[model samples]
Target: MSVEGKAKEAAGYVKEELYEHGKPPESQKKAQEGRDLRNEGRVEDGKPPKTTKPGTSH
Candidate 1:
């Protein structure tokens, strides 16, 4: 393959890896939203939000 083709192939691999295993964990924004819903007793399932640790998967 040409240099450009090889570079594109490598980039494709990187994109696939990132898609399969997402980037590093961030804040619990989604969990917080769930908590807010729980606090308001508006949760769909009437369940509290699941807690998440920093740098850990939800």
Candidate 2:
């Protein structure tokens, strides 16, 4: 699965629990929007932050 997929899947679980408390975590919205943007190949406006983190050498 893509990063967004993983994020959304995790968010879904949190969202379910949050609803009982009448609150939504920002992660839920961010995850959903990220999924949409990634699907369209326009992540962060095609300009992701520069990073030297391992596993991210593109």
Candidate 2, lDDT over the whole model: 0.42
**lDDT per residue, candidate 2, 1-58, as tens digits?**
3565445445543443444333456645654444443334323234342233222445
- Top candidate, metric lDDT: 2
Candidate 2 regions with alpha-carbon error over 4 angstroms: 21-58
Query: In candidate 1, which residue pairs clash?
Result: none
Clashing pairs in 2: none
Q: Could you estimate the TM-score for every candidate?
A: 0.34, 0.31
lDDT of 1 by residue, 1-58 (tens): 2454444444543443344333434323433443343333322334343344422555
Worst 10 residues of 1 by lDDT: 36-45
Q: What is the alpha-carbon RMSD of candidate 2 to the true structure?
A: 11.9
Give the Å shift of residue 40 in candidate 1. Answer: 50
Tell how far residue 1 is off in model 1, in angstroms: 2.0
